[model samples]
Target: MKRTIDFILAAAGLLVLALPVCIIYVLVRWKLGSPAFFRQTRPGLHGKPFELVKFRSMTDEVHKLDSERITPFGQFLRSTSLDEIPQLWNVLKGDMSLIGPRPLLMSYLPLYTPEQMRRHNVRPGISGWAQVNGRCAVSWEEKFRLDIWYVDNQSFWLDVKIFFLTIKKVLIRQNVVGVDVNGIPFTGTSAESSSGK
Candidate 1:
């Protein structure tokens, strides 16, 4: 039932948002040149690695230096949460789900403590309990705690709430800070004892 819902929502979302994304793609091509999609390896369920997809929200060059070097339009896409739209493909491919802990880079997998690694018990998501709650504004510890909590309490209804919360978060344009490159190094297994477990 969950996979069914994931497929249906992911497919329907991709279909409906295709036209806007086309416009964004053309703009990105004109501005940043080819490869409007950015693909990166991330840990999926049970810490399995997969190519996570997103609309390119950074110049290929910017990626080489830092994501903060992102173009103005790229920043807009990220702040608006549109960069995440392409992950529906990952969903359709069964590499991700519509709702789960957001995937993190493969580099972070080794850093996970036994409890932190619990986040991988389910597929990664485009949006999760942490996203609507605080996103990048929250501390790394808070974020992981939320992720672990989702692992224990996830349900169809919880996913639905997260979906609706995501829409509201996007509309209000709140807590949509960029990925914290220099802010907080992901603490992983060393995360100051996640009390939320």
Candidate 2:
């Protein structure tokens, strides 16, 4: 049932945003040169890997940090979440759901404690409980807690709630952090940050 909804909505989204997606693609290409899509392997359901795609919001400056590489247009994309429009394809591809725990880097797999690891029990999402709650504004530990909470409490109604909240957050542009500025790398389990509960 959830998969059905994800597929239907994702398909509709791609169709509805087709023109805008193309415009963003062309703009990204003009502004950032080739490879307008940013693709990365993210852990999906049950820790499986899938390529997550978004618009290229940063310059191809290998020597510079992500924070330094982000362009003004990229910041606009991030603030408006236009960069994520391409990820509807991921949902259509069965790599993601409409609502679930947002996928994290595969490198962070080993860093998660047993409790925190439970987030991968379901498919990753473009928007999740943590995203609407605090996004990058909250601590990584707290984000994990929210993720786990969603993992445990997820339902049709919950997804419905999150879907709307996500719209509101994106419109208001709340809690978004600059690239690599506030999203601290998770090292491993610690007394202060390990518990996902």
TM-score of each: 0.89, 0.94
lDDT of each: 0.80, 0.86
What candidate 2 gets wrong by more than 4 Å, as runs, is 175-181, 192-197
List the RMSD of every prediction in angstroms.
Answer: 2.6, 2.1
Candidate 1 per-residue lDDT over residues 1-197, each given as its tens digit: 99999999889988998899899889878887788888888889898889987888666664466555688887788778888888889999999998888887777777777777888999988888888778766777677789899999999899999988988888987644334423556756443354444
Q: What overall lDDT, based on C-alpha atoms, would model 2 receive against the true structure?
A: 0.86
Give the local distance difference test score of model 1. 0.80
